[model samples]
Target: MGCNPLHALYLGAFLPRPPPPLPPPGGKQDRARAIEAAVMAHWRAVRDWSPSRRMIRLASPDQEQEEEKKRDLPRNVVVEAVQHLLEWGRQRDQVRGEKHRRNEEGLRPPPSSPQSPSGGSSSCPKAPCSEASQPASNSQPSSGETSEILNQESVNSSPAELDSGVSEHTNISSKEKTPSGLSNPHSQKSEITVNERFLKDYNNIECIADGGFGCVYKAHHLLDSTQYAIKKVKWAIGKEEKVTHEVEALAKLSHENIVRYYTCWTGKDIFPSEDSDSSSGEEKLHKCLFIKLELCKLTLEDWIYSEESTKNYKDDAFEKFQEILKGVAYIHEKHFIHRDLKPANIFISFQNIIKIGDFGLVTTGADDIPVKRTRKKGTKSYMAPEQVGQEYGNKVDIFPLGLIWFEMLHRFKTKSEKSKRWEDVRDGRFPPEFIKAFPTEKSIIKKLLSKEPSKRPPAAAILRMLLVHLFRSSSI
Candidate 1:
């Protein structure tokens, strides 16, 4: 055996090892074979992992088919769809956060500040008549109620004053102190606490318009017995910066044709208790912004539809159009674009003055250079082609003005007709009636509505043209 050990090792190395005998073909053997097959398949899947394969593995047949269909879509289309989904998810999260916040802190109603003491004569130098000077009766609420109102009013009571340019005759009460600790003899301190006073002074609180951002209330000032409009807007979580920007822009604007911004106030809700259940009990407090603005007799749209305006359209249309141009020119002069200019945003004051309002979408230039807007904002029907989704200058405003001007010149019998006219404008077509009536204006309108923004005239040029037309028409 010892002599044969080396020979046996050599023979073992050369010989192949026999395989294990197969199990008998029975129930247990079959089951074991199936299990082994499944294990091998799973191992293969793990080794060849991919998104599509993983999806196929996890999804139902129907789901997989739907995914396959989506995969066949254009790359850009797929990317846009994904982006839309992501945006929707973000918006949903924001909405949930807003709901949670609203639940925690109840909605704050509009502030009803304490009324100013009555029994004052027309202190305003240019104050209307004695009848208009009468002070409104202040509601005699209890001391505690007054205190609560005062506390709420304190939110926006930071000392601010009306611009002296607003009204030359606006008499500032000697008691009101300026920010510099000096008495401003010209302007009165804009008191947020005086909102209740305004409510007391104004008898009627009629809601003229309701929009997504705010409500417009028509009220009359008891002191001057003059009607005014109050815009009350609800403040959203991320829109504070936009609101602030609008306020700042409006503060700087002081054109006779532009809507006068009297004052603004922010109100917050007073939550009684942190533990108060908003869901089962009462609605939560909502923060809001109140903007006091000059009252107007009618918007340009209303004026256009009014019997008086329609009857004397030929006589007054040019004058009113000139006023509109003046307002827009002033806006441009201030290096701002009245991005949302439309008939609805233009106002006809009681004095027949045309004023531009609604600076919510206004954009300003940096260092007098033109600003480019990337987003498609403003009423789509009135938007210029460049405004739809292109880099545009202030000349973009001219296009809408041209539309408004065209509208002023022609009267549409139906909304359908009006829509058709807008479509025609979009396609660079002017109404035959407008062309026949005003050939010169047609040329101007064509330039204004030009597809190329650079070709459109500046606001100053438009104003000059309007002025020339006014002069010629008046002389004729």
Candidate 2:
């Protein structure tokens, strides 16, 4: 049988080989199972601690007997407890190793230093052949060319960067964010192309996402060498109203919390369609709108599910929520409504600023209410109760803000926890345990999610309530 590592520290301090514990029935797993409630509680405390921190509390040769009495953990219980910590260390090390490997392979490009203010170009990865004009056929850089570009980037990088193992990408999925703050890190899974004209000014075009509307690409500006998110949307030649409404909404609103809109242009672009008859006819060009947008680090949706959630959470939800409210307030003040306000639409920038983007479903009219059939325009899960085939106003935004508040305050260990929390909070009733911890939040959540649209507080009002709550809590 293998030596119990715990025995080495506690028993083998003086002797070369530590004496083994009396073997209990059903082996290690059952011996662990057989531990009583009190012993198990101690095991849990040890299990919860980090390995380095665990070492500090462990028994030392000089103070062995005193430590044993303090712990009150039996030899057998120690064996099982130590096993748990070892497993934790192993898992942590494994994760670190994978991240290191990814860094070495696909070094994340550093964020361009802020020089041109808007461009954010400086001390960053230089784009390959920014002036190289390719033929129309080679408009979009191929996957191979992208790889070569990344390779060239690494080769051209300063020797100091290479030695320091500077990464150009952040593992947002893994919560291993870097100074570079690159989100939706590259993988060759999806093969989408960028518009030829867009490629002329923006090099290193990589598809960030593709949906029914169109695709969003992460690109580097040729002159400024700054990174930007270019959302290239497709509309049926006559059905360009959505794009128009979105542009109008964005153009009217200006706030620090809002996503920065650089510029936009319209053009016709070739798109692959199932209906196209390749052999019989030439490819058709479709109406497309390209919007140059501020490239944010990651969406709020990414932050919620990150590893820091639940117990490890940084608890910056309110701070983030405040910024969202500011942006929404400005939109409402400007006589617009973010009809589709959700975690996915909220963005976090490199400087950790909150930016609200994706105004595709924004509405301009203040008292305008869409028909019953159009109620399904926003995400169903975050949709307000009054928004269902009813005459709703700006307060429609408040309901989802309430939902987002609950999501931020509650610690959901799993996806199921998150889903269940949504169901439980509909009546303004939170779990007793949660309420005991956050006594004030339940009231705010209730006010925001009131069934009547008229009852729901405006974004500005909610901001006041939050500020008041923050002051009260800080004073306490």
Candidate 3:
């Protein structure tokens, strides 16, 4: 029976590609199957294309009109169906997470195990400052140690990630069908047998940092001796689209204050596996991705502990922070919320300019929707009040940047001094000298660290206020 489609052909192809036309005339059974396959393959090339793109591709205007005749279902209904399916998956994942949590909680403590005697634990595992209501403990660790504690979350290729305006499955024609990256267990400090060709690409590789995903190395480009940071990770086979999307999204971000992303490529069997007995030799030859980025002299963490933070450099730090803010403003403008913003992620170039790096934990930004996020997404000590598995917004990044601002401006003579004042400053309690000197900036930082995400001004607004402050100061 021949059925006519409902009148929404353009919208139908958006949520998913509509079915292709009936196979061309072919009498043989195998011939019909091949024809049908070819028709579907033709449609695949046009999948997810916009209406304008689809129209441009059609040789005759009536082609789409004829195509519309084949679909019987309403376009709105198809959209609804996709939304329902997405929601169902979300709920299913939540159910599984709850079950796993219960199982872990119900496990009886072993003798001599360090499980708390009271059997009371925060919902966030290993979270030193998970609860917003509770007072911060005096024994909080440095940001570097917190990074190590939360490194477990670093391995996840996709953790409730939501991005817009980027295609996950962008066709890398030459490399699409080829094999890339390694087996999962390769991040365990295992022996790496890098290809001789790969070695020739770089020189003087030094391990700068390591996490669950793998290591970030500082290397000199063999061709020009230009220093760069190369982040290595197993090519996430199942989630290559998401991985590629992450790379593509950041690559569009072209700002001097933000770290420059040079390129990303798959190293097919270039990093050979060392483990022999566990898997076949062919499996060991999987690929890995090498992300080349601009290398800088040191991090904001190293800057905080320096003597320059004491007295004379307060104005200089403020100026430098404005540059950092510009970078963050650009990021937010492009709709990327840096979920794991902290001092260590902010790099100080050899020229003394601050550049933001480590886009390893970005989520959807500047959105009005409030949705549940992955619980273990950030370093605990620097996490926003709403970041403990609750619905949050772009202000989560603002909170940590407030902390960074305070660290850069304040005079912390020792580790003991920093620990003693961490909570007080975090809560907007400013020292008399600080309040006297930088009252305007203090108020700005206070608003940035506000408990409510809505209360924090967007980066653009803050930059405007900073300019006004500078203008008034110069006139005075």
Candidate 4:
């Protein structure tokens, strides 16, 4: 997303340009102005796509055509349309060039490199600021520490919230509140609103990244004032009422390794939509929403995929991933599988702790829907066999996590081969020797990578065994 800072710079260049002159009222002038405004507005919609390109298609094209037929544009709307055209032309040119470059190069670029967090590129170092040296405290930790504590806090607070809410299953315990993060006061304010309910007894700061589905900002608590990551998701995509469900699921989830959801809020107000119209659309608006929590710095994928780190830790990314597994094990305990787990979704905090993030694709033990849906979800390369082909359960997550683990542990990238899917992982594609080192847990890993969903270990069971093994190993 930030792979090129030039994109923002280019967009900035055109932003200051004056819109085309408006025609005088009535007669052919009004009609000509109206047609021009409509065309400009349509062009702008394609230019200001959220995060990346796909969002422009969200609006009903048929609706656009119908509206175009009856456009009696006002001067203000014409100005907006012209402004959009200026911006769109610049953006389209930039994207086309980048696409050309990518085609020439064999590999595609990673989204949003650290150098350019706002969809730009910079020659910045991978380690922006060194790890904060404050001793781990009870109240809140650094971004990395916050990741570990978030789930713990969620588990702790879940009981009270769940008591009043309607739920599909009663098996969930109330003891699941993810810990709150502490945000730096010096950070900039986020464009998106952080619900006061979620910010209760906590501190928050400016948002750094806003993707298509959600936005990420830095925040902290009032008590500790430690900085953490706050993610608010756009609710206008499909389901309106499901925002609370996401927040609740986050509230009940806790694990030292898994990124935690501190609190969530959904209310009617002016909010940003994922498919907001660039032209003739006001920014300070709202519809419905939900927010999640965690503490993180960057992702393992960012570290590995970036040219910034290519000269640095290409060899040592494996050990970094093992640390990630420790956290993944923690999440599996509650029987929740992070279906959308990936490098970008995984975050590192101030403490350099690995926290699994993005529970949008999470699936639970209770769902009876054949484990697989027709629509494919999750990252392509890291996807499990069942996720790619058949229906599945929690084990689907384990496969990708394991691939991430393998990449991080071995510091090896998964070679893209047309036929090398998860189904064929057993035959040298994913060597058995990788899992053989950990005797007791090796079976679990193998089962997790199994072609058959029924053969894999449940998240809860995996959590217990890994924690026990990690503890036993640490004690020795």
Best by TM-score: 2
What residue runs in model 1 are displaced by over 4 Å at the alpha carbon? 1-203, 222-224, 269-281, 366-374, 469-476
CA error at residue 429 for candidate 2, angstroms: 3.4
What are the lDDT scores of the predictions, listed in order? Answer: 0.62, 0.65, 0.63, 0.52
What TM-score number comes out for model 1? 0.55
lDDT agreement of model 3 with the native = 0.63
At residue 416, what lDDT does model 2 achieve?
82
Q: State TM-scores per candidate.
A: 0.55, 0.56, 0.54, 0.45
Q: Rank the candidates by TM-score, best first.
A: 2, 1, 3, 4
- Give candidate 4's whole-model lDDT: 0.52
Candidate 4's TM-score reads: 0.45
Best-performing candidate as measured by lDDT: 2
Ranking by lDDT: 2, 3, 1, 4
In model 2, the number of clashes is 5
- Residues 1-476, candidate 1: write the lDDT tens digits: 01122222234444444443454577954645543433333333332244565768586978867655653434343333334333434443543454344334433323233234673433432322221344522222344543342233122111110111121122223244333333332432222222343344455566788676666778766456677888766677997877776778889999899999988877743222331655667545557677889988889998777788867687688778888888887888888877788999999988989999988788885323445565887888888777777466677688898888878878787898887667887556887777799887778888888887777887788878877876887799
Worst ten in a row by lDDT for model 2: 153-162
Tens digits of per-residue lDDT for model 2, 243-290: 777777777777899988888998766555432667867666677888
The collision pairs in model 2 are 107-168, 108-167, 108-168, 108-169, 109-168
